[model samples]
Target chain A: MSEDKNDSFLSRLKAAERRSGLKTEDDTKESADDKDGQSLATLALRAGTEMISALIVGVCIGWGLDKWLHTRAIFLIIFALLGGGAGVLNVWRLVKPPPV
Target chain B: MAGGSSIDVLGQFELHSVFGGLGDALHFSQSPVYMMLAVVLVLAFLYFGMRPAAVVPGRFQAAAEVCYEFIRNMAIDTIGPEGASFFPFIFTLFFFILAGNYLGLLPFSYTFTSHIAVTFALAMMVFVLTVVVSLKVQGIRFFAHFMPAGASLALAPLLIPIEILSFLSRPVSLSIRLFANMVAGHVMFEIFASFVIMLAGFGVVGDVFAIGPIAINVALVALELLVGVLQAYVFAILTCIYLREAVAH
Candidate 1:
């Protein structure tokens, strides 16, 4: 029912992939996808959509809490900052340079 | 204590509280504790699941093996055979998150993954780990990943910066994807649950109608369980895709 037809040890890449459990395709290896290299900024911008939403939500929640507690925006500022920091952090994690 | 997003993302069964609480801080900040609980859960699962490695294999072992194999297949299929080495890491990540997720589904427990800090921290670890691996494997050549195969010198000026920008955006997508999904699922669970609880004590009509929320909650809990695994898988697998680019590039 199942088999290990393709098995090889490449090195760091292999280790990372295996750990992530994110298999793409085999056969030709990682070749087939040479479409005009997609720009890194494009993906980053796409991800920005999520970041922006998080920021708005964090800020609104914090602000609403401030309103509830009558404590101004103390939590709002912190949450907002955290939200922004998270946005930048996401960029740091995913985007990568193109292959040579 | 469970607030924010709630759909009972994991088939949130109402868990009996295992430990007494410390204070409001401990009660509100349930991430670390839940994570600790999840770790113990995994240990228990492995202990019971693998102690009797039989020829025929017991249901537990069979089930555990299936979990491992599924991820194994995912890694091999996504990352390749070299991915076998990552089996431990993937398994750990999968179980840890899975446990954390289910733990939150427990009644009155804080869902750590629902918190951005926790999710971001986890995502950041993966990001940093991948970078370290790439640099170690490729050496100085790793920087060359910035350049595309055949862009003209003129185009490089514009395209290269764009490439760099996207490269930097990984963590944003990675972290938010997990955090958002978890939070969203949980929120749905909460809203539906509140509906059930509020409507449950109204006598005959309320009692008869209570089944609606119960049924919905049950279904939601089941769906959330699937989502918990799905999110974990997506997070781990995306790491593989990004790693491929890092290593080969």
Candidate 2:
């Protein structure tokens, strides 16, 4: 009779946990760890692409402006330098920790 | 696939008119067709999954709810309460790319995301939306962001252009990342698949060696599955982040 009561109590607790959609502390931590690993990979990928894309955008704009103005590589040179700076800035923004 | 003795790896990306004359006349390509198919598939999945909305929730209903809640939580958490207003857009973007990525993994299917044109279009849309939202939310103050706070006025000329370039690079980076990742994965698949085919030509010993490439291809498929979902998640979360900045005081 005591064993039967214990089983019923355990079942009731399980049912309440399910109803509340609560996870054990371990479950939440494990999932968070997994997500952190994935996001790290994503951050690495974003850094390289972000840098290159910024440079590309800068070069393209510079080339277009030079062509329109007949500046003979002046705009291109200026833009390329600016674009390179922007690329570095982009990478910096990506890797820097968020402000508190 | 191996065309004669040479591997035509890039042949898979070529666009061709489907449905014979009708498609040709309409200038309809496989990219848009697959996009439509992806849309239809997502809608049908949601419709059927939710139609039997039992109180207890069946397996299909559970899966649909999980998807909904996942995007809902992502948006709300990333963008605050204003995210609810943008939930539909993020959900649609996430699922659309997710569907496109997974669908492309199937044999004889085109991965539209592999195209820079398609990804750029999507990225531009997100970029424009964020800009518009910022302009609306912050008024003329939106231009102030081009000049970083505490920056000296003497360096504004050089810094302003660099800032603008970095800002413009958002869509470029967004599009290129997705496009490049998809293209690289598919190209690797094609190369490995061709290796298996090429190796099979030398009879029994060749067939035995072909297993090496086949194994790699199998592993690649698993990796691609992860890549597909991860890329979708990254895209959606980045959108949320951008929107958060846009709406912030």
On TM-score, the candidate that comes out on top is 2
The worst-scoring run of ten residues by lDDT in candidate 1 chain A lies at: A33-42
Best by DockQ: 2
Candidate 1 CAPRI classification by DockQ: incorrect
For residues B168-199, write the lDDT of model 1, one tens digit per residue.
Answer: 55665667767776777787776777666666
lDDT of 2 by residue, B126-225 (tens): 9999999999999899999999999999999999999999999999999999999999999999999988888888999999999999999999999999
For model 1 chain B, give the 10-residue run with minimal summed lDDT: B6-15
Candidate 2 Cα misplacement greater than 4 A, ranges: A1-40
Candidates' DockQ values?
Answer: 0.05, 0.75
Interface RMSD for candidate 2 relative to the native interface: 0.5
lDDT of 2 by residue, A9-90 (tens): 9999988886787766677899999999978887888889988998899899989999999998998889989989999999
Candidate 2, residue B60: Cα displacement in angstroms equals 0.4
